[model samples]
Target: MARPTIYSDDIANTICEQIAEGRSLRSICLDEAMPAKSTVFAWLADSGRDDFRTKYVHAREAQADVLVDEMTDIADDGSNDWMEQKNS
Candidate 1:
């Protein structure tokens, strides 16, 4: 029997939008509204849509930059302990 589809363009778009907004894909996928992480990975790697793949990659890169910025902030902040760095 065929498996139920846990993915759709609307869901994909929402994931991409979350990434664009500096959210982690893992965290986004963990939400009950989003699909499984494996499903999202399969979609990105095999969906055969250059536009969507490119957009997702770009958003991922942006999110990486945001993470680095946050790390830098935590390091520069003498007020917070090493483990006390911001959650996001």
Candidate 2:
């Protein structure tokens, strides 16, 4: 019996990209004619690239939140100063 061929990084990346784009794993596998769903998952898990992607996404979201808070503070600063003057 012939052994099944292992998928390459390019193929795995395509699968991951498709998933990130909202394609279901079953749909991708069926469209791509992939041998098994587990194979795609294994590729993603083994590559260690997903971990970095997750970390990057989280960091970017945190940065955005911080920027929004800073902008809010700047916008409120004048109002706060006016209120203090009125109170005094």
Candidate 3:
């Protein structure tokens, strides 16, 4: 199916939700049901889309937090950082 061009509150919310869940806009746009990346960027550039832009910004901030938490978890994990040694 062709991606959506005309923006809607539902679509905007869906995009924001996924973004907050640590998904990239490029990946989200790859979905056949979502809008193209250019379309999303156009929405951001459009002055009339202040609300959507605000939501998108907040979602990105949340995504950053999620990424930081994941990084911390990975850094804290040393399960694979060492290898077992055997006596000769």
**Model number with the top TM-score:** 3
- Where in model 2 is the C-alpha error above 4 Å? 1-5, 44-88
Tens digit of per-residue lDDT, candidate 2, span 6-82:
86655655655655554556787775445467665565466566763564345446556666777888887876564
Candidate 2 TM-score, true structure as reference: 0.41
Judged by whole-model lDDT over C-alpha atoms, candidate 2 comes out at 0.58
TM-score of each: 0.71, 0.41, 0.91
> Which runs of model 1 end up more than 4 angstroms from their true locations?
1-7, 81-88
Task: Order the candidates by lDDT, highest first.
Answer: 3, 1, 2
Question: Model 3: residues >4 Å from true position, as ranges?
Answer: 83-88
lDDT of each: 0.76, 0.58, 0.96
Clashing pairs in 1: none
Give me the displacement of residue 84 in model 2, in angstroms: 55
- Poorest lDDT segment (10 consecutive residues) of candidate 1: 1-10
Error of 3 at 40 (Å): 0.2
1 or 2, which is superior by TM-score?
Answer: 1
How many residue pairs clash in all the candidates, one count each?
0, 0, 0
Please tell me which predicted candidate would have the highest lDDT against the true structure. Answer: 3
